[model samples]
Target: MGGFVRANEPEKVISLFEELKEKLGGGMIYDGTPYGNLMKAYFMKGMEEEAMVCYSEVLGEGSKVRFGAVSYNSVLDALGRHEKLDDAIKLFDRMIKEHDPPRRIAVNLGSFNVMVDAYCIAGRFNDAIKVFGEMGERKCTPDTLSYNNLIDQLGKNQLVGQAEELYKEMGERGINPDEYTYILLAEACFGVDRVDDAVGYFKKMVDLGLRPNANAYNKVIGGLVDVGRLDEAQGFFDQMPEKEVKPNVASYELLLKAYVEAGRLDDAIKTAEGILLDESVAFSDEMKELLEGALRKVGREEDIAKMYEDVEREKAERAARAAEEKARAEALAREEEERKKAEAAAKEAAAARASQAAIEAVLGRRKEAAKEESPDGGSNADDGGILKRLGITNGPVEEKRAENGNVVGASVGDESVKQDGEAKEGAGSGGAADQATAL
Candidate 1:
């Protein structure tokens, strides 16, 4: 039957049990090993209704079959797992209260744990505590494991205060809290915003010389991260090494994820480096891929080849590449700026030359006209013609003059002014052609 159960051949076990019953026709089998196996087979085959009926007939009032604590705990677990809480409680009551030989201790510590677990499933946490309290009346004094089991269920449901009461009770009862006990208490504390309580439990565990595993450290660190106590989270991570507890991938991953999300890439990279340094941890591809997928967005992902290489060398290479890229970009920018300035200066010079050429051409034509007009080597009123072509008005307005001995301003447009080729050529500089026509 055990073989059949291990093979998951529940129907075959049941059929064999039925055949054995038939062979023994009018006799009652009071031994519970076979009956318990039958119930397990029923459960294994998902025959919950049949299993429940079988449990009642075998263990109910006036029944000859006597199931010990092992069988009772098994069925209780099944009931708890399947959410058959009410039935589980009723069976638990019978186990504790069964008085054939008046042996209440027939229900072992497992019986109490199972009931606590069942109550936890139903969210009847106070009832779970009550179940533990009733253990004394049942003549079963729970050891550290029993307390740990009950506290584990309470912690799972975030019943921090109740779990703490249990922890307090353990100390009072002289049962030393183990590593798992402290770990569960710490998690429960964190679950209920009691950060100080959580940290204290960790300290308590250490003070008692209990070596916490990577998982224990991770739970405390993760709780600290959850409540935005990032500094404390980082502190715990750092303390792991000091305590001789090596941080695993999960330990680093918790802080890495927190750092990256908080826009702290440097911190994330630092945590990632810690993972690479720990050779004991298999840096599986899934974990590596997860980290890279997250870090890739910020362009801070570790180089896979460099992950296994010399750390300092990898850092140096990355810094060199970044500096080289920066310098190249700056150089390109400076070249672009220089090119633009040179183009602007060259255009200005071209415009100045064009303007000068236009002025020279007009002056040359007037110079020829002046030569032809004054062929007798005397002055004519050619000044007016030259001035008219130059776009200066022929006016008697004395802008500047010297009357006898009195002084005045320079005559900028005095019609009486006379000049030969040199004067006209000199005056051509201040021409009416503005820079607009230069190009």
Candidate 2:
């Protein structure tokens, strides 16, 4: 339903709403969103009478959706947009007067804002102020945004004096002014030819730390130029630099066009030079043509052309320098990355070498252990005791034979007897093997 209304399909919304109402036995939801959409749709299709029925007469029959602040505010906005001031007033009055639950909602900040805008558009500045004043009574106090809106609309309508009152009132109320508030007041003062006040607002905005944008600066500068105060306008423009605010093409053109109109070709040329030097803003083609037209009036067309070419050449050189500097930085970064990688690789190789050395030491010790395990005492003098038990000796060969487990006890009588006598002689040295040999 909201989509239908937003899509401007007023007829679909109305028809579907009716169908849903009848099918659901005249029960329509009214949480303000759909109702608001429906009302806006009616306003779009010029069905204000039907909208009024939904707003006041019908009361949604069996629908449990109560009309709260949102619903009331929505309708009020719709009325304001459609230029139904009388209807908006009635609704606002009812919001303020009605105090019962579900039916009478407390007027919120938005409720008064709608009325303020409505009155502002209707050119009733006094009524607008009155409504702004009444907000505190209703407990929906107007904040900075509310004051700004009122000031803007009043400014647009040429009510600068009334706007000034609001501005002072904002300060008194402790509602801190934003950059936009100052800009609006400045422009409004300009519209009313209060040039001094306009300049003061611009400067005060800067002094108060509410930095004005390029548009705000340009507006004040342009207003000054319009009143034949070229030097003052130029002064404001000069202040932009010290303030660190970048001016756009319009900012330059305001003063440049003024100089050209007054036949100050040299000043125009100087401004053109400043425009080119401004690194923050681009020098557009229109600005070039304006300067060219101004110089051509003095028959210095070729000079202006050559000056523009020089500016372009300077810009190109600056760009090239920037690119070169970027490339140098990137090269340095890559070199640092490569150095780190090389260091890491060196450390890895050193660790691998240390591990290899440790493995070789372990294997060398194991080789010595392998020799020790051989029963023949293979190159290890530590195995001499076991050798004696095996009875293998150039000196004690019988003892060595008996230690080797040669079981010839009874089969080889003479040899055994001989070996046994030798074993007995070596018994003190051979230990257990000599006893076995004797047996």
Candidate 3:
């Protein structure tokens, strides 16, 4: 049955239950219990008529099956939950009529609590109070939950004094206020600008050994934020965890807004960063996105520019490193090329020296033989003497002379051509002089 409910196939189960009830011979079984369960399901499914009919049928079964207090509360709770208060009251009256032992049959606090809650929700605070009064008259003393519910409802309705008076009444009745009780009264006081009063109740909550929940802290923080006491609000926020209470999204948002309103933009930004980065602080996607938008709206342009500057600096550093690496590689390649060139040049110089030495030795021997053949031959004298002095001569002398003559003649011709050079120089000078004279 739990599986059926979780699986959202209640109708299938309802049909099966109906078949089982029909086959089992109705009076032998407690069919009334399932009706209440089905009522809850039908209401959840928005099948109000079916739920009410199920209730009516159970009531018709009378004392044969004990419909019990849960059954009565179920119908009441369902009708009230659906906002069918009038129907809920009618069913409550019917339950009163169906008491087996008549006068001895008692309605418990649970049933009364449901009706009280219903009246409170319906804004019949006077009627709700009257019902609570009657419960006392009937010796159904209001419990802690009863007072808490009433106080919460009154606070929500903005009846701060009324909530306080009820708290006083509960205290007079010897019902020691719990954490929820104080939280409710504080909320009421906060709503009505009674910050001092709210703070008093919060102190009482602490004294009573009741750990304030997030809502409790939020109510107080919200009050502080509203009064523009941001520093005090911050103090309270800082105290939350020490009290075993954690700030929820509402608490954080109230503080953030306080910081913003106080013109403490840095504080606001830090608070937002904590929310975003703190591992222990869980935030919803909606809240995260909302804070991001708020930060962008309030963030300074200089701050953004600084952030971009840091990013650009990092990028420039990376680029410089990459350029240095490229330069180093180029230098390495150039060094390798230079080393290869130096080695090749050294080898070429060594080979040239060896070839020159062999040519000089061969020319020396040839000159000696020529000089012996004709002692007066000026050819051997000039060739051997020049070769011996200069250290060269292995190729043809005529070729050498032609090569040397081309060199010598070009040099001598250049010296001999000085007159023409002087004539051109003088003519050029004369033209300049003539042009100058003309000008």
Candidate 4:
């Protein structure tokens, strides 16, 4: 059944499930596993109606299945994935409500987390806060992930103070804030124009022995760059490599943009050269255009031209390589086609030879049978006559009669023929013609 789900064959899953239910009998008590599987399949197939039907059937009072937390979490996750946050919230509410012993599905931390994230995504911060509060009311302690979701969402929605308060609350609860917590708090402070607070959180992150990744550094650098804090941003940028965190393309781009905006053409050019030095960094067309525009604004046409020339060279080289590859591919395809044609031609020639050999064999056998049937063992004279008619051999020469019914021979060139009945044995004066008659 898991295989069917992984293979994305929802119809097969449904059919197999029906067969299982039939074999197990209608009175069989099902756990959350089967219902979760059904809900997952329906969700994957985007069959909301079918998924709801499955959920309804599982939650039905007469149904023998006792749906658990896993079942409720699975359905909630499905609803979240489909962007049905409203329905997810409703389901979450029902999960928290008291139910009979057999039908009760306790709402877990994962359940609250899903609802909070969904509400945040839908821009309903108040609803998200309400759900977060309910977690406390239900005695479900929020974990790091839960807090992270709310803090990040609150930051994005410009509620940085609230998010900061939550951060303090985490410390008060004896929760050790992880790297993500610090990153989010920093981002929240930055979002609300609290640059110093943002930097403080970043420093706090380092003090906590947490390594700030490229994304975290980029956010801090970008935030500083956003508010004309180029010196501080550059300071952070320079510290990245020292901290063993490599500056990414985004980091370079942000710094370069800040330099260009500050009319620091030399600095921008130097930064671009640095980016070029790092082969790992890909200089995108957008970045290229940005740099070009900056150079143009500063009246650095020579540098602009040089940059365009380099870009053109790179483009030409890439085109040349692509053309070379295409040529090689075409050559290979032609070779393969020619090879097949040659093989076919060889096969046809062999077939033709075999056919000819068979015909010749049949003719030879017919001749041998004819020879055996002949009474005189096939006389040589008859064989010779047949050979002569077929132009296979020379036969006896016949005499040619003249107009007077007498035997005649070749006449000498430019000489009158002998009119007498006597034959001349001597060679004629025309030696060439006499030699021809001698034959």
TM-score of each: 0.59, 0.63, 0.58, 0.56
Candidate-wise lDDT, in order:
0.76, 0.78, 0.71, 0.76
Candidate with the greatest lDDT versus the true structure: 2
lDDT of 3 by residue, 365-385 (tens): 777766667656534225634
Q: Which should have the higher lDDT, number 1 or number 3?
A: 1
Top TM-score: which candidate number? Answer: 2
Considering TM-score, which of the candidate structures 2 and 3 is the better prediction for this target?
Answer: 2
Q: How accurate is candidate 2 locally (lDDT)?
A: 0.78
Residue 223 displacement in candidate 2 (angstroms): 1.6
Residues 1-439, candidate 1: write the lDDT tens digits.
7688779899998998988888889376776767656777888778878988987887778898867777777767767766688888787777766633444335777888878887888888888888889888767788999899888888877777788898899989898889999999988888888899899999899999999998999999999999878889999889988999888878888887787678676676567777765667665676566666766776654654455466667667878999999999999999999999999999999999998799768856775777676766523345445656777563432322224322232233553444332355454544535444775
Rate residue 36 of model 3 by lDDT.
54
Q: What is the lDDT of residue 132 in candidate 2?
A: 90
Residue-level lDDT tens digits of model 4 in 126-175 = 88888887787766799888888888889888988788888888889887
**What are the per-residue Cα lDDT tens digits for candidate 2 across 104-139?**
565778888888988877778799889999988777
Q: Sort by TM-score, best first: what order?
A: 2, 1, 3, 4
